[model samples]
Target: MTQPHHDGPRTSVRPRPAGDPAATAALTLGVEEEFLLLDPTTGESMPVADRVREALSGTAREQSRQEFRHSMVEMVTPVSPDLAALREHLVALRRAAARAADAVGARLVAVGATPVREAHRTVPDEPRYHDMSRRFGPVAHDPAVCGCHVHVGVPDRELAVQVCNHLRPWLPVVQALTTNSPLHDGRDTGHASWRSMQLERWPSIGPTPHFDSAADYDATVRDLIATGIMLDAAMVYWYARPSASYPTVEVRVGDVCPTVDDTVLVAGLVRALVATAVDEVRAGRPAPRIRDCLVAAAHWRAAHDGVDGDLVDLRTGRPRPAWDLVDDLLAALVPALRRHGDLDLVRREADRLRRDGTGATRQRRIMAGTGGDVRAVLDHLAAQTIAG
Candidate 1:
């Protein structure tokens, strides 16, 4: 469907401050990560998010928040203009969160989903969460899934919308790189990202349709809310969207990475993608015209196979090796990466992930090597989560 050409609510882009070094920097970005709290010995999900929050009261309190489930906690970093600073901030936040979880007799696991949690019975004490539980029933409570959201600065709402359109086809490639959930409810789901499958149960979550302008995007979101399909703009859980609370475009397609380096790699690549999109817009290039259905199929294929199998390459609408797609993605972002002085770091991290396998592959290997012991899988995840 073509987007309606109408001017509606818009956020004005502000001019950069004189002599502000950040204005000349590549792109400011931030990452939000959700983690599962688990008992150290049994590897079972622990409903101690409130306790962890209390433990983090003084230090890093602003950076951490409670998720929908009591078994999950989310950590967000401040805006960072470069990869090195981003890594430092994220690592410190992870360490502090780990310490808080440890104080509550639980450990944080950065896997996409808890392997042994059959159900989530403890919901946060927030009113919004209560409403969600009442409205969604089992699907809301069944999710112990965690994910990583990357936000790249794009102050102009129009440019942000255009960037989202340009970014639609590449999101599946990001998903494939960060597939960390394989086992669900103590059994292999035969999919790399079982967390994604669980999240897809939501009515408003998935690939987004093309929007010609910010007004078109706003109209679509308003229409969905008007139908009572979702509560508000926050519920528009597309893989990529303009952030409602910030002047940035948020990429919500990646699983919560198990290792800090993986998170940094994904963040770098996402920033590069946003930069590339912005450059395209400046060059008067229209966004790619791939159909929403094709984009959705690509996401499904990536979530199903991850880096271990073929993905529906958006360039040709044909299946291709996931690794090859990753290479192509890197090639597409080379100019942006080089401009940002992050090409070497991104390349090294990608190579490392390719050699060692993604979190999903490693989790499967642990399960197989341990004779299908889910506890061993949890142990590996915990170790990796604290490895940085």
Candidate 2:
């Protein structure tokens, strides 16, 4: 990727006047969700992603790509200007992928990790993947994990990098809202998002540091590359980063959600966060200055308990109920959501999520109801994956 001029993101792009959402076309959003191909009976990952990929047609085939493991595949939505359109696109794509999986005798499960252990660890035949496996060894096992990535368009690369700075603290709260992986390797991990824990095995995966400017961000990336820890810029697994290819900021903190509604809620909140941050940047406001360890603690707490337990609120450095932090996040983003015409959608879905609880809580409930049968949880996930 060619480096662009770094004059700061706010040099030419000022805060928008309070106007219709349609007037601000640059805020278009996209989502990418990774899924696992599982054996319907055993719930272990099936190494038939190539067959499923071949079966996909139309939009699903066009927008989808293979993940590192042969048991995994990723489907991305097209750039959507509104939450409703994003929902429609996600529904269609997921349905198409599910159909393809069925045709190949595999069940596509929208989950962060398989309930049962996958012994195969089938790495793809691609050269880059082979190199990764050779270099990283056991760390390559982490790619078996799935995640939901949200991409929000910005005016330029500079703006996207700066937005990531403002987004540092909020990533943990958002991660808690979408926690889905509770059972892993046929056992309850006692953590809401086991996938989040799995991801940290990779050297590059963690909280993004606050960058003073795009130049500062670029310098850090170069230094990491020089250390030979990461293969390239694309390998930096920060919670959020400026897109390597698109003029957008991609937030990769949340685990892949169970249903379309959960995914949509994540996208709406993330975009609103980015919009609010952009406004502050244009207004010459400073980003939050909590210590790095506190931000990491917040992330760890979110992964451990999700919505079922307390989170360390960064403001006071004290633990608060997870729900309270979620509500505070919503309150902070209301103006941005309203400006983007997504206020009602976000609010409604948030209430529903609160009532239904995080995916981890639901999984635990099912585990108890079924007398500790892990297969039952997989069955529930299979049905929810294509329920749209």
Global lDDT scores for all candidate models: 0.86, 0.86
Q: How accurate is candidate 1 locally (lDDT)?
A: 0.86
Task: Give the TM-score of each candidate.
Answer: 0.93, 0.94
For every candidate in turn, the CA RMSD to the true structure comes to: 3.3, 3.6
**Model 1 misplaced stretches (Cα beyond 4 Å):** 1-25, 118-120
Give the alpha carbon lDDT tens digit for every residue of 242-311 in model 1: 9978999999998999999999999999999998887766655677778777888899999999999999
Candidate 2 lDDT tens digits, 1-388: 1223455433333454545453334388999999999988888888888899899987789999988888888999999999999999999988998899999889988888767878778588888888888888888865378899999998577677778888987888999998999888788999999998888788788888777677778787998889788888889788999988778899999989999999999999999999988877666566776787888899999999998899988888899999999999999998889988999999999999999988888889999998999989988988898887
